[model samples]
Target chain A: MSSTASSTSTQIQLASRPVGWPTPENFRTVTVELPDLAEGEVRVANEFISVDPYMRGRMNDVKSYIPPFALDETMTGGAVGRVIASRAEDLPVGTAVLHQLGWRDIAQAEASAFRQVTEIHGAPLSLHLGILGMTGLTAYVGLTRIAGLRSGETVFISGAAGAVGSAAGQIARLLGAERVIGSAGSAEKVELLTSKYGFDAALNYKDAPVREQLPELALDGVDVFFDNVGGDHLEAALDVMNTGGRLALCGAIASYNAEEPTPGPDNLSALITRSLRMEGFTLGGHFDLADEYAQRMTEWFAAGEIAYDETVVGGIDHAVDAFLGMMQGQNTGKMVVRTA
Target chain B: MSSTASSTSTQIQLASRPVGWPTPENFRTVTVELPDLAEGEVRVANEFISVDPYMRGRMNDVKSYIPPFALDETMTGGAVGRVIASRAEDLPVGTAVLHQLGWRDIAQAEASAFRQVTEIHGAPLSLHLGILGMTGLTAYVGLTRIAGLRSGETVFISGAAGAVGSAAGQIARLLGAERVIGSAGSAEKVELLTSKYGFDAALNYKDAPVREQLPELALDGVDVFFDNVGGDHLEAALDVMNTGGRLALCGAIASYNAEEPTPGPDNLSALITRSLRMEGFTLGGHFDLADEYAQRMTEWFAAGEIAYDETVVGGIDHAVDAFLGMMQGQNTGKMVVRTA
Candidate 1:
C-alpha cells in the first residue's frame, strides 16, 4: 500500500446535462488535492456510495420536492465512509459513519452531517444506510402513515425488486397483510421476491402487459398499491383498485427520463367510481419520524423478522457507471459503490 | 285544507338513458295508487325532495360504490316527509323523518328505513336532508379526516355555489382557513359565495378559463382543494397546489354528462413534484362520524358561526323540471323540492 503522503483523492463531477438519458460524456472523473481539516469538520475516506432513481430527478433543472443540483458540482448521494482525521468530539479517527458525501473517494464535512455507526445489536455498517437508513424509513412512513394500511389488506408493489420496493413488500407482510403481490422487470427478480423476500406472488412485468396481467394477479382487487414506477403502472393499478383503495405514490422511475410529459390516463374516472386515495411523499420530508423508524427496523433486523440485499460495486472510480446502470434497471437490488 | 284520505301519490321513473345530457324526454311521471302499510312499516307523505349530481352517476349502468339505477325504476335520492300513518311501535303519525324514498310524492317504507328527525332535533324537516344531513357530513369528514386540513390553511372550493361545495366553503372558513376561494358558473352565485357565505374570493368560471384565472386568484398557492367539478378545475388545482397540498375529491360534475370520458390534464408528474395528496369519498361510507359532525354543526349554527342557504322549488308536479334545472347549474346552494 502507498504511504499516506503519496495517496490522493478521486472524484466524479457533472460535466454536462443530458437531453434525455444521461451518458458517460455527461460525467468526468478527476484527481483532487486534499486540504487541511477545518474546525468541527472531519475528513472521511468513503467505502460505499449509493445510487438511486431520485438522482435522475435531481439532474433536471425543474422545480421539484428537492432542489436541483448545480451544474459542474460533484453529484451528491448517500455514502458510508471511515473517518481519517477528526476535529469533532462525536466522531473520531477510524469511526464508520454514513453521510451524503456524493461520488468522491474523500470528503471533509461538518461532523454533525455524519451519523456514527456503532454496530448496534451486532448490525453491519452497510445495513446502516440500506435497511436502517433512508430506504427503510421511506417504506415505513409510506405504509403506516400515508397509506394507513390496515391488517388483512392486500398490498401490490410495483418495481418490487428495487431497494425501497423490496423493503416495503416485506414490511407489509410482517404487518399482517393478508396477501402481497409484486411486479418486477425480470424473472430473476420475480424468483427473489417470492423465495427470499416472502412476497406471496411475483410477476415479471416484461412477460405480459401489466394492464392485462394485473387484474388476473389481483382478483380480490388491491387494497393498497405502493407505486415506484409511474405511467402505465399507475394506469394499470387504477384499473384494479378496490373501493376505498389507498395508493402510496413513492417514486416514478418510468417518467424520470421521458422526453415529453406522459398523457393522463382515460381511467381517472375510476377515482370517483372507486373512491380511491392516492398520496405522494418523499423520505426527506419525513425525517422527523426517523427515530421511531430506526427503533422498529432495528428490532425487526435483530429478531431476523426482516432481511435486505445490496449490490456493491468496487472502487470510487466505478461510482458513476454503477449509478447510471442502476438507473437503467441493471441492478437487482440496492446498488452501492465500495471504495477500497 | 283537503283531508289526507284523498291524497294520491305521483312517481317519476327514468324513461330512457340520456345520450349526452338528460332532458325531460328521459323521464316519465306516473300516477301510483296508494298501498296499505304493513306491520313495522309506515306511509311517508313526502314534504321535500333532494336532487343532486350524485344521482347522475347512479343513472349509468357501470359498476360503482353505489348500485346504479335500473331502467324504468324511480330515481333514488334522499327525501324528507311526514309520517301520515304508521303500523310500527317507534314511529307515529305527524312525525317528520328522512329516508331514501326515491322520486315519489308518497311512499310506503319500513320504519327501520327512515330516521325520525323531529325527535332528535327540533329544526326544520329540510335541514334533516341538507345542511345537517349527508351534505354537511360529507364536508365535515372530507375536511377533517381525508384532507387532514390544519387551521389557517388556504382552501379553494370548486362548484362552490352548489350543495356540498357550499357547505365545504363555509366549513373551511369556520375551521380557521385563512383564505377561502370558490368557483361557480354564474356571476350571481359568485357574489353569494363572497358576500353571503364569507368566502375570501369567488370567481365565475364562465367569465374566464379556470386555468388562467386560478393562479391569478390564488397568488399564495392553494393548500387544500375541495373538488366538486373534477375536469379542468382539478387540472387548475394541480398547477397551483403548494408543497404537501391536500385535495378532497367530492364529485366530478364536469364528467357526469360526458358522452365519452373526457381527457383531463396529465397530472401524475405534478403529484410527484409537489408531494400532493388527492382522495375521493362519498358520505354514506362515512356514516360512523355522523353523530360527531351533527353535534359540531349544531353548535356552530346556534352560535352564528356557520350559515347555510337553500333553493326551494314548490310542488311535486314540478319535481322533474327542478331536478333538470339543478343538474344544469340553474340552482344556487342546496336544491330542495317542497312537496307539501
Candidate 2:
C-alpha cells in the first residue's frame, strides 16, 4: 500500500472508564500517523468536533439503547470537516463534509459515510452539526412525534441554553407554539434563551427554587414539558403541568454522574390527575425521520425562521475539557472542538 | 316549594381529611330528606358506587386537575342508578343511568348529566363503572392513545388485577400485543390475569422481588409498561424497558398512602439511556377519545375477546371497608358498593 507522508491527525481516546463523574484522567491525547487513502476512502480534516450530554451515558459500561464506549477507543462524535484528499468520484478533495469523526484532527473513512456540505444555501458548515443536524432533528422528533406537540400549546424546556434545548425552543416557536418557557442554571443562559433564542420567558434555576419558580413562570400552566435535566427540574415541571400535558423526556443531564441515582420528588400521582404524557427519546432511534426533519429544518433555516449558536473549543486536546464543561452547564450553546 | 315526605336519601360525607392513609373515621354517614324534583332534574336511587384511587388525591385541599373534595361534603364518584322521578324529557322514570352521585343512596341531579344505560346490550349495570365505563376507558386510552401501543409489543402492567390494569392487559392482547405480562398482589389475582384476562404471564409481586422476576417474565424485554403502582414497580420497569419503549403512567397506588412521598428509584437515568417514554394520564383528560374507546371496547367484549371482574360490597355502610380493602390489594378487581 502506498502511504501518505503529509496527512495530519490528532486524536483523543478513552484512557480509562470513569467511576462517577469524568475527569481529564479518563482521556488520552494521541498523535496518529495517517494512512494512504484506499479506493472509495477520503481524508477529513475536522473543523468542529461536537460534544454532547449523550456521550456521558456512553462512557459507562452498563447496557443502554446504544453501546458504551470501549476503553482506549477513540471517542466518537458528530463533526464538521474539510476533505483534504479523496479517492472517490462522488466526493472530491476540498469539499466540506460532516461525519461521526471522534475527537480527532484528521480521519480516513469510506466516502459514502461522509456527506458533502454546500454553502450554496448560505449557511455555515458548523450549522450541519447544530441547528441543521442531529441536534435539530432531536428537538423536532421529540416534540412532534414523541410529545405529539400541537400548535398553540405552551412548552417548557429544561437545559434551555444548551444545543438541543436551544434548537428545540426556536423550533417550537416556528411550529406555531403559543408560548415557550425555558430553564437554565445561569443568568446569562436565561437571558440567551429569551432574547437570543426567542423564548417567551426563561428562568435561572439556581436563583430561585424551581418548584416555586415554575408556577410563577408558567402562570397559564405548561402544555408540553421538554425535559433535559431530570432531578428537581422534572419534579417542578410535573407540579406545573396542565391536564393532558405531554412531557418529552429527552435527557437527564442532572443525574448522570452521581455514585447513586437521585430520587425524583414524590408527585407521581399527578400523572393520573393531570393525565400527563412523559416520554424519553434518542436521536439514533428516530433515524427513520431524518429526511423529514432535514427538509423542515433546511426550509426553516433558509427562511431565517430558526438560528443556532455554538461554543467551539480550539483543539482535540481540549475536547475532554469541552465535554466536561458542557456537562457542567458551562457552555452557552452547542459545544464543539476544532481540531484541524 | 313542595318537598318529598320520605327521608330515604342517605349520604356519606368526608368527616375529616386523613393525614397519611385514610381510615373509616374520616367518613360520616348522614341521612337527609329528599327535595322535590326541580325543572330539568331527576331523582335517582344509586345502585352501585365506585371507590377509586383518584379519590385519595381529591381529599387533599390543593390545586389539581380535578377539584379537591370539600370537607363534610359527600364524596363524589361514578355510580349506576335507576331514575325514580324526572322533570326532563330526555330522562324518564325506570331508566337505568350512570351519573356522578357522591357516596349516597339517593341523589337529585339535572337529567342532562346522566347517560341512559340500556339493558339491550346484555352487559350488566356494574360494567358501566368497570370494564364498560371509566375503568375500561382508562386502559384503552393509556394503551392506545398515550402509549401509541403497536401490535406485537410486549406489555407489563402493575396492579394487573385492579379494574384499570385488568382491562389494560386484556385490551393490549385484543390490540394484537404479542405478550402481556402483569403483576398483582396475590397468587389468585395472578391466576386471573393469565387464565381469565388473557395475559401471557402473571406474577404475584408480593411473593417475589419484581426487579428479578420482570426480566425473566418479559424475555423479549418490555416495549410498553402500563404502570399502576409507582414505587419500586416503576423503577423495575424502567430497568427492563427496551430502546424506544413507552411507559403509560396510569396510577401510583404504591405511593398513594405514603406519608412522605417516596423518592423515585435511582435508575431514572435509564430514561435517557433507553430513550424510553413515560407518561402519566387520567381517564377524564382523554374524554375526547372516549366515544372511540367505548365503541372498540363494546365490540371486543361482544366478541369474547375481553372479560372483566369486580368485587362488589353490598350496602352504603360497607363502602369504607370496601375502599380500604381495594387499597390494601384485597379486591381481585374493581371494588364497588351496592346500595339499596
Candidate 3:
C-alpha cells in the first residue's frame, strides 16, 4: 500500500444523541492521521460539506428509512471535493468529485466512493451540493411525482427560504402553476420569495399565525402543498386547501427538535371533507427521475430561469454552528460548510 | 291534489344545530295531515328509518359534501318502505322501495324520487339500509378503491362493531387480506367482531390506550387502516404502520360532536419515515362502483359469508334516543328506527 506520509483529516463526530434540541456538547471534533492508500484508493480534500434538515433525523438513535449515525463516528452526508491523489485508473489527480463524506476537511477512501462532476461555467464547487445536486432533485421529485402537480394548479410551499423549499417554489412556477405562495421565517426571506423566487405571495410565519395569514394570501384555496415545515404549517395548508388537494410531506422541521411528539393538524377531517391525499417521501426512492431532472435543470440553469442562494460558513470547526443556525432558521438558502 | 284524508305522517325535524353532543331538545317530533298524492306522487309507509353516524354531520351547519339539514325541517336520509298508495304506474301499492325522505312514518313524494328494490328472499326491508345498501358499499369502497387492499395484506379497522366497520372487516377478508384486526368501544362488541365478523383479533379500546395496545397486537405492523373513529385511533395506527402503508379515512366520529377541532396524531412524522400515504374519501364520490358492490354483497349474504346486526329502536318517538345511543357507542351494529 502506497502512503500519504503526512495528511490529517479534521472531522466532527456525534458525541451524544440530542434531547429536544442539539447543542455543542452533543458533538466532538476529532483529528485523524490519514492511512496508506490501497491499490484503488483516493485522497480527496473536501471543498464544501452540506448541512441539511434531513441529517438531523439521522443523528437520533431510531429506526427510519436510513440508519441512524453511529455514536462517536464522523458525520456522513453530501460533500463536494477534488481528488488530489489517486491510485485508480479512471479518476486521476485534480478530478472534481462528490461523495458522502460530510463535516470533514479531508476524505480518503476507495476511488469508487466518489462520483466525478464538472464545474458549471466556473461556478463554485458548492453548487453541486445545492441547486444542481440532491437538494434540487428532492424539490423536483416532491412536486412532480409526490404531489402530482398539474399545470395551472396553485402551489403553496412552507420553509420557502430553505434549500429544498426555495428550489420547490421556483420549480412549481415552472410547472405552469397558476399561482405560487410560500411561507418563511424572516422578512428578508419573505421578500426574496416574491422578488427573487417568483412566488406570487409570501408569508412571514414569524409575524403571525400561518393559519391566519395563509387564507389572506391563498384566497382561492391551495391545490398542492409542498410541506417542509409540519406542525402549524401543515394545519394551515389543510385549512385552505381546495377539494382534491395533494400534500407532499417532504420535511417536518417544526417538530424535529421536540422532546415530545408535536400534535399534528387539528382539521385533518378536511382530508375527508375535501377528498384530499397526503403522501410522505424522500429522494432516495425516486432516483429513476434523476437523469430526466438533470437534463431539465441544466437547461433551466443555462436559460437563466433558475435562481439559488447559499449561506456558507468558513472553517471545519464552525460546521456545528452552521448546522445549529440552519435548524434555527438562520440560513436563507442552502447552508454549507466551506471545509477547505 | 287528491288527499289521503284519514292518513297522517309523524316526522322528526331538526330543531337547531347541535353545539356539542346532540340532545332530545335538538329534535322535535311533529305529526302532519297527509295531502293527497298528485298525478305522479306516491305515499309510502316507511318500514325502517336509518339512524346513521353520517346523519350527525348533517346536524351541523357547515359546508361539506352534503348540505346540512335545515332547521325546523324534517331530517332526510336513507329509508326503506312499501308503497301503500300510488298515483304512478311503475310502483304499485305493495312495491318495496327506497328513498331519501327519512325520519318520517310516511314519505309522500314524486314517484321519480323513490327507487324500487326487491326483497331478498324474505329478508327484512330494513336490510336495504345496511348490508344491501349504502352502508355495505361504504366499507367496500374504503377497502378496495381508497386503501387499495390487495390479497394477503393485513387490515385494521376502527369502530369495527358499527355498520361500515363490520362490513369492512368481512370484505377485507373476502378480498384475500392475510389478517384482519378491529377495535371497538366495548368488550362485547370486541367479542362480536372476532366471533361474528371473522376478525383475526379485536381490541376493546376502553380497556387500554390504543397506541400502546396496537403495538402488541400489530407486531408485524399494519398495512391498511380503515379509520371511522379518528382521534387516538389515528395516532395508534400511525405508530404501527409498515413502510408504504395506506390509510383510508372514512369518518372522525371521535371529534364529530366536539365543539372544538380535535388535535390529530402526534406521530404523523411516521408518514415521511415510512413513506406512507393517507387518503380521505366519502361514499358520494365512489358511487360509480355501487352496482358492483351490491352484486358482491348479495352473493356474500346468500352464501352465509356476510353477517350483520342492527340495534333497532322501536317507535318514532325514540328515534332521537337511537341516534344519541349510536353516537355514544351504544349500538352493536347499524342503528335503525323501526317505524312500522
lDDT of 1 by residue, A96-125 (tens): 998997888887778998988757656656
True contacts kept of each: 0.61, 0.80, 0.96
Off by over 4 Å in 2: A1-5, A120-124, A288-308, B1-7, B37-42, B85-93, B120-124, B288-307
At residue A284, candidate 1 shows an lDDT of 59
Clashing pairs in 1: none
Q: What is candidate 2's CA lDDT for residue A280?
A: 72
TM-score of each: 0.92, 0.91, 0.97
Model 2, range B256-335, lDDT digits (tens) per residue? 78788678776877776777777777766579987898788778777877777889999999889988888898887888
lDDT of 3 by residue, B33-117 (tens): 8876788888898989998888898898889888999999999999998888888999988799999998999899899989999
Candidate 2's TM-score reads 0.91
Best by TM-score: 3
Q: Return whichever of 2 and 3 wins on lDDT.
A: 3
Q: What is the two-chain DockQ of model 2?
A: 0.63
Q: Which stretch of 10 consecutive residues in model 3 chain A shows the poorest summed lDDT? A: A1-10
C-alpha RMSD over true interface residues, each candidate: 1.6, 1.7, 0.6
Error of 1 at B209 (Å): 3.0
Which ten-residue region of model 3 chain B has the weakest summed lDDT? B1-10
* Residue B188 of model 3, lDDT score: 93
Model 3, span A1-340: residue lDDT tens: 2244238899999999999889999999999988777789888889899999998999998999999999999999999988877889788878899999878899999988899997789578898898899999999999999899999999999999999999999989988999999999989999999999999999999999998999999989999999999999999999999999999999999999999977888999999989999999988789999899889998899899999999999999999999999999999889999986
**Considering summed lDDT, which 10 consecutive residues are worst modelled in model 1 chain A?**
A1-10
User: Which candidate should be chosen as best, given lDDT against the real structure?
Assistant: 3
Task: Give model 1's DockQ, 2 decimals.
Answer: 0.54
